[model samples]
Target: MGMEIPDPISIESVGTWSDEVDVVVIGAGMAGVSAALEARASGASVLVLDSGGRLTCTSAMAGGHFYLGGGTEVQQATGWDDSPEAMADYLGLMSPECDPAKISAYAEDGVEHFRWLESLGFEFNRSFYPEKAVVQPGVEGLSFTGNEKCLDVAEVVKPTPRGHKVPVPGDTGGAGLVVGLALDKLDALGVEVRWETGATAMVVDGDQVVGVTWKNYDHTGAIRARSVIVAAGGFVLNRAMLEEHAPDLLAVESNGMALGNTHDDGLGIRMGQSVGGVADYLDKVFVTGPFYPPGEALRGIVVNKLGKRFVNEDSYHSRTSAFVFEQPDREGYLILDSATMVQPSYRFQPLVDGWDTIEEMEQGLGIPAGALAETMAAYDEAAARGEDPEFHKAPEYLVPLDQGPWGAYDLTPGKCFYAGFSCGGLRVTVDGQLLRADGSVVRGVYAAGACASNIAVDGKGYASGIQLGEASYFGRRAGRRATAEVAQR
Candidate 1:
């Protein structure tokens, strides 16, 4: 087993401080950097300590999408009139367990947040990619990266594109660009960033958090600060934490495949918990079996071990993936025919095998001989009539798979590349103030990014860009709020 979760150290024991800052932020990813920048901009001396070198964060490896809405310039340029209320309606449905205040704040402040990011040198094209895709193949500025366009979600609110991609070529790079630009801004502002330094414990004085203890190699020290913002990333890389919180994700081989980096080992979260920071949703996780990019593959149907359709293939990949995990033994297969089966553009879902007939495919899949045939016949009949009453797949993708050479794509967690990360962490208020189990705020400490459970709580309701978007936006909130406290002091 790993080392036991540490308790917060009382400040009375640590008599000397090697350094002092008005605000100290842990982690240098989007959240941490945003917090540092906001605090410094608010005229508070700021310091950032990261366990890893620059650009080594999971944010750097992302596709660079930001889940922005509420009349962003890009949305206006693309002829879509999105409102904060509409965006909130969609997001609230996506993460129903999230604090409504946080959801409302994100939605209401989204467009301004977009402008804030742009002010930091982030860029978005004035174009849009109108497709059901994991990410825009190239930078098209905006796209539908969530379930907003799905039949059920659209019924709740007018469907509008909200996923704003940075104006960089390729699927990835937006994250790196955003992180790089934030770091550049931090450099220009003279905020000190200590890399390869980890926060070992939260130093407390009485009931309020006062600072953090740190360690670098053999050196051990602490920083005295009026306030601290814990923007440390999630705990996906920590196996023990995973087994304890989100054991279902442990089934997937995520040591190398997960979206998170090595620093996401739960220490930051544990640090918050050590200080009586309330953490909830520790079971929520985001797992994906990215089966699209060819887009046509979504035209196929996903079945379980009993050869029965389980989810609407048209839903977002993570949404569908959550359903896939609920199947017996977590067995899931994407059934397609010659006309719909194509090489996956993203290439995570692997093609199992092809058979000349549905009967042959069933035998290969090891299900009851007639199970797949009946399901295919029913699906073909509905497709021919341009109707999907069972799962409500959009009519555009409702093409019959009557062509010969039927096949399956293995979506079983271990069989296919299912990547996942933890969604739960310390609980915080809308303004980024850490909360206790009884909902009282923890003074002198704030949290943002993955360390704090903002929005984006459930995998079934998750969108593509919510993690980065919420991290940066809430990071700013936490930083600004923490610095405002310094002024009050």
Candidate 2:
């Protein structure tokens, strides 16, 4: 035997049918699959491994909205005037530490990324829905899913809709059908996809990553490959990783659940970190609040248990969700009225207690005699005057809550349906090369999607489709970069 390997790989002999391919991909989610497809198309023998025993993942569970703009075909079809400069300006405001080069690259080439996804047989509709929504409301493919148009915000970029919802409908939404189509394309391309195979550690050769040691069901062996691509997702599910790196997010009440699928346990990140890869943004988690679907909920106000308005009610869903977690006791309620139509979310069904008047509702909620009443009076007065002096809420959603039949939905951590996903992962360059603490690139290895945190790490700044868009976009870039590696070749 060459050298005694440890737990994940126990081999009696080397090269015992346990060798590998040109590109060995760990985690077969959107990023991994995208990387695999690109590598295979580049004439490299590719192998994809999944911790999940199947093709499904957190990507599959998503609404399938891919945030794309920058004069894309869909934007052209909608006759929406948008450019790369506008995209860059709008997205740069999301996070202070967001990579400047990466944002520029995304704004300039996201249209091509959208087209690449189309080449994978994924399709987006040409129509645009001119409304604010978490996902597309109608069959239209485009909508505003961020703070792009919110009032009192940075007006440097003229607003345009960017959330491109994929054409997958029914119970599963866009993820089910689009991933299925990509699977068909990968199959046609002869990409080897192995399910139930989990990479446990990196097989490093000096400063370069040679391969990885993995466990496939009962079989444990090392796959010696030319290069490795780790798209195995972030550490949201790994309690130890979260506690060690991002304790604040871990300590936050997440309604007792991590937003991602079970396989998102930081295995890929850990494997990369073992070989000098640096992880970042572990404190950033995208939290989705139970707000707006009927559009009427936008007229409502959210308050802490102390009955104080915490954020602009009209902010994007993710932004609203993050602020709710910052409230006292990590809980609150959505205060609304008869004009504010209440629509229930499939995920969040907080107790909706309706009362005849503000005073009666305050009595029912036990919000210290005059606190909630005064808050409502101020909000109603501002709405009637067609302005929100307190929170700068948009005038269109500023309809007064004066009408009786007031309602309050629980926005508590354990009670409401607040969902969060760990957005922190390995730090990478604009080209998807995993970086070290010393800013050195981990040669022969690449990472993308939630496994990397150079993009969209600001939980409060997330736009819908950003994760999916980044996965497919940078995954392909990483894939192309890996295939061009002369050492690997």
The candidate that wins on TM-score is: 1
lDDT of 1 by residue, 1-489 (tens): 243578888989998998999999999999999999999989999999998999888889888889999999999999999899999999988888888999999999999999999999857999989977888888799999988877767777898888888877777877999999999999999998899999998889999999999998899999999999998898888888887789878978842266788888888788888778878898988988788877888889999989999888889989998999889999999888988877777677778999999888999999898998899899999999998888888888899989989989888887788888899989999878988898898899999898889898968998888999999999999999999999998
Candidate 2, poorest ten consecutive residues by summed lDDT: 1-10
Clashes of 1: 0
Worst 10 residues of 1 by lDDT: 251-260
Candidate 2 on 296-388: residue-level lDDT in tens? Answer: 688889988777898988888878878887888776788878777577545474765889877778878767678898898898888999998
**Candidate 1 residue spans exceeding 4 A from truth:** 1-3, 254-256
Backbone clash count, each prediction separately: 0, 0
